[model samples]
Target chain A: MPIIQINLVEGRDDKVVSECVREVARTVSRTLDAPLASVRVMVNVIKPQFFAVGDVTKAESAAQKDKS
Target chain B: MPIIQINLVEGRDDKVVSECVREVARTVSRTLDAPLASVRVMVNVIKPQFFAVGDVTKAESAAQKDKS
Candidate 1:
C-alpha cells in the first residue's frame, strides 16, 4: 500500500487541491508500480501563520515584504 | 530536523488537538534526542468521508455499524 502525504499552504482553490491530489496519486502509482486503487493520498493545508522557515512564519514574511 | 506527520480522524476537541500536538513533539524530541525546537509535528485531520479502509469510507463504516 502506498500512502502519500502532501503538505500545502492553505487558501488554494478547491479545483487546484483536487487536481493536486489526483495527480500525486497517479504519479505515485505509476512510479511505484502500485495499483492506483491501493494508493492513498492525504493533503494537509497549513495556515500561513502556522508554517515557518528559520523561525519566521510565512505570514510574518509576507508582512515584512509588504513593508519593504 | 525531525518532522513528524500525524494523521487523525476529524472532530476532536480543539484542546485535545493542541495537547496531542504538544505531547507528540515533546515525545519525539525526547526519544530522538533532538532539540525540542527542531522537532516539527504536523497533524492532519481527515473527514470521515475522506478516510477509508478496505475501500469503505469511515462514514460508511459508521453508518453500517449503526444499522447493525
Candidate 2:
C-alpha cells in the first residue's frame, strides 16, 4: 500500500482537509494507475511557528491575511 | 496552528517513519519554540510509481538499488 502524509497549519475545517486529501489522492491515483483503496492519506498539524512558508512561518498568518 | 504535509512512497519500516516524525517534530518544536505536544504528525504512503523523486518514481527502486 502507498500512503501520503501531509502536514499543514491547523484551523482548516474538516471540509478543507477532506477536499485536499481527495484532490491529491485522486490526482496521484489517476497518474500512477493506483486504485483508491491502495492510497492512504494522513495529516499532521503543527504550530504556525513550527512551519515555514518561503522561510517564513505561518505564524504570520496576519501578514498573509490580505494576500489570499 | 499550522500544518505541514509530506507525501512520500510507502514501505519504509516503522522505525524509519518514527525517526522521521520525531526528528522533524523535534526540529520544528525547537526552532519555532512550540511544545512537543502541539506538534501532530501523520504519514501517508504513496505507491512508488505514484511518487516522483527528482522527476522519477520510486518504482525504479531497482535502478536505485545500487545507488544507496
Candidate 3:
C-alpha cells in the first residue's frame, strides 16, 4: 500500500483541496501501477509560521524585504 | 526543515492525533538536529477500504475469515 501526503500553506477552499487530493491520489496510483483502491492521500495545510526555509520562517521572510 | 506525514486508519480522537503529531514532530526535530520550530507534521486518516496489502483491500480481507 502506498500513502501520499502533500504539505502546503493553508488558504485553499474545500474545492481546491479536494481537487488536489484527487489529483495526487490519481498520480500515485498511475505511477506505481497500483490499484486505485490501494492509494491513500493526505493533504497537510500549515500556517506560514510553522514552515521555514533557511532558518527563517516563511512568514517572517515574507515580511522582510527581499534579501537577494 | 522537515515535514512528516503519517497515514493510518481513521477513528482516532482529536487528542490521540495531537499527541501523535507532537511526538512525530519531536522525533523528527531531534533526529535531524533541526529547530523544533522548523518541523511540521500532517496526519492522514484513511478508510480501511483505501489501503490494501497483497492486492486485497484491508477492509475486504478483514471481513473474510482469517486466511492464515
Candidate 4:
C-alpha cells in the first residue's frame, strides 16, 4: 500500500482538506500507476506552538505578524 | 524543510500520538542531522471506510474480521 501523509500548520478547512486529498490521490495514482483504491492519504495538522524552525515556533512567528 | 507524515488506521490515543511525535522527531533529528525544532511530524488518522485495498475497503476487511 502506498500511503502519503501531508503535514499542515495552516489551511485546515473542510474544503481545502478534501480538495487536497483528491488532488494528492490523483497524483499518486497517476505517478505510481496505482488504482485510487490502493492509494491512501493522510493530512496531519499540528498546532502552531508545537511546530518550530530554528528554535522559533510558528506561534512565535504568528505573534510577530509575519515579521520574520 | 523535511516533513514526515505518518498514517495510521489505529493508535490514535493521546499517549500514543504524543509518543509517536517524540520518537519520530528524534529519529528525524538523528538521521537527517536536523535540529529537533526543525523537524515536523504529523500523524493522520484515517477512517476504515475511506481506506481500501484491491477494491476492498478497510471497513470490509474489518467486517470480515481478518478473513482477507
Instruction: Give me the candidate number with maximum DockQ.
Output: 2
Which residue pairs collide, candidate 4? none
lDDT of 1 at A68: 100
Q: List ranges where model 2 is wrong by over 4 Å.
A: A61-68, B1-68
By lDDT, who's the top model here?
1
Per-prediction TM-score to the true structure, in the order listed = 0.55, 0.45, 0.50, 0.52
lDDT (Cα, tens digit) per residue for candidate 1, span B1-68 = 99987898677898999899999999999999999999999887886655544344556678899999
Residue pairs in collision within model 1: none
Count of backbone collisions within predicted model 2: 16
Comparing 1 with 3 on DockQ, the higher-scoring candidate is 1
Residue B13, candidate 2: Cα error in Å is: 24
Q: Each model's number of backbone clashes?
A: 0, 16, 0, 0
Q: Order of candidates by TM-score, top first?
A: 1, 4, 3, 2
In candidate 4, stretches whose alpha carbon ends up further than 4 angstroms from where it belongs are A66-68, B1-68
Instruction: Supply the TM-score for candidate 4.
Output: 0.52
Model 4 docking grade: incorrect
Cα lDDT tens digits for candidate 3, A1-68: 89886787666797989998999889888999999899989877765544444334555566785654
Q: Among all windows of ten consecutive residues in candidate 2 chain B, which has the lowest summed lDDT? A: B1-10
Tens digits of lDDT, candidate 2, A1-68: 44666666766677776766666555545544568777676767777777775777777765688688
Cα deviation of B13, candidate 4, in Å: 18
- Candidate 3, after superposition: displacement of residue A12 in Å? 5.3
